[model samples]
Target: MRHIIAVLLENEAGALSRVAGLFSARGYNIESLTVAPTDDPTLSRMTLVTTGNDEIVEQIKKQLNKLIDTVKLLDLSEGPHIEREMMMVKVRAEREDREELKRLTDIFRAKIIDVTDTSYVIELTGASRKLDAFIDTLPGGAIIEVVRSGPTGIARGEKGLVL
Candidate 1:
């Protein structure tokens, strides 16, 4: 089964490398990863998506907690949370196709953040599946490049993950 793990760690140099190395050393693959500094500059939050069974997930969590730099680990897949991903897509578009592209973008709640004579750069944030569907709706051979900030999740209610 696929699992999403959120880790809060000290924002120290080499901390990310250590976490990544731990997974690689164990032959576990990370499907998606996003990290950023939290309100506290001394700490960073990371959300990682991986595929593993219950036992493996628990083992991974236990091992992560053992890392000195790790502050907390939460299994978001089993919790009440709000998950989102951001993506930017550059697609080739002509004047004639611009209107249609704009319409589709509106339907997906995406915005045209940049535009050139031959391309339109769109910014969107939503669930992973929603972004995938938006990308699929574009014309064939129109996409130039795409960038994604892997999914990030947080517990929905007042009860946050315990340290």
Candidate 2:
């Protein structure tokens, strides 16, 4: 029931607020949202994750398209696409734990981006489940802090989503 909806809209002040307000006013939920200016500086691209059955999702899409700022909209979840999220985890890496953590990082193909005598920051990028699996491999109390850039996605093949 989860959906990833990609939208291109005018990159102006209050644009994001309007989109978020629409969801709130309608009592809908956005699990994750990532927005940034696109190649065309006059526009911005937003990727939002939400959940609902087909009917609810269709209704949400129609409402989004009604917005004046919206240039184009696509439900990437409807077709072939790829999704990824990036996660950085700082863990207790001291003494014996250092070797174990290193081994686990290698197994996950994650990079040890930052390191100190007693801690390490490991960066991993992949599907949300892959990140969860990596976190599960760490020993209890080993985690210091975690940061994630929620999933972003795009459709596969030749065509691009555009107006």
Candidate 3:
């Protein structure tokens, strides 16, 4: 099963490396990871996505909690939550393809952030599936490059992570 584990940890040197090393040492795969300092400058929030059986996930959580820097850990996938990823696609948008690209962008509610005579950079943010679908709608061979910020999530209720 895939799990979105959100972790609050001390913001200090080598903290990220330690967390990643733990997973590497165990041979577990992290599909996506996004980390940044939270409002309380002393801490950082990490949203990590990984796939494993229930037992493996449980182990991962336990090991994470044992880390010196880890302040708290929550598996957002366990309850109501929201996830979003940002993707930017640069595609060939020549004279003939410009109209079609604009139409497709509108359909996906994406923004054409940059425009050149022959190409465009479109930015989209949504669930992973929505991003994938937008890519599928683009013309074949039109894609020049794609950059995605892996999924990040938070719980849906009034509750949240705090110091």
* Highest-TM-score candidate: 3
User: Candidate 2 lDDT, tens digit per residue, 1-163?
Assistant: 9999999999999999999999999988899888989888999999999999898999899999999999999999999998888999999999999999999999999999999999999999998889999999899999999999988888999999865
**The CA-based lDDT of model 2 is what?**
0.93
Ranking by TM-score: 3, 1, 2
Write down the lDDT of every candidate, Cα atoms only. Answer: 0.91, 0.93, 0.95
User: Alpha-carbon error at 24 in model 1, in Å?
Assistant: 0.6
Off by over 4 Å in 1: none
Please provide, for model 1 over 1-163, each residue's C-alpha lDDT reduced to its tens digit, 9 standing for 90 to 100.
9888999999999999999999999988789988889988988999999988888888888988999999998999897788899999999889888889999999999999998898899999998989999989998988999999999998888987545
Candidate 3 stretches with Cα past 4 Å from truth are none
Taking the tens digit of each residue's C-alpha lDDT, what string does model 3 give over 116-151?
Answer: 999999999998889999999899999999999999
The number of the candidate with the highest lDDT is: 3
Error of 2 at 50 (Å): 0.4
What's the CA error at residue 73 for candidate 1, in Å?
1.0
Better of 1 and 2 by lDDT: 2
What is the TM-score of candidate 1?
A: 0.96
Model 3 lDDT, residue 36, Cα: 94
Native-structure RMSD, model 2: 1.1
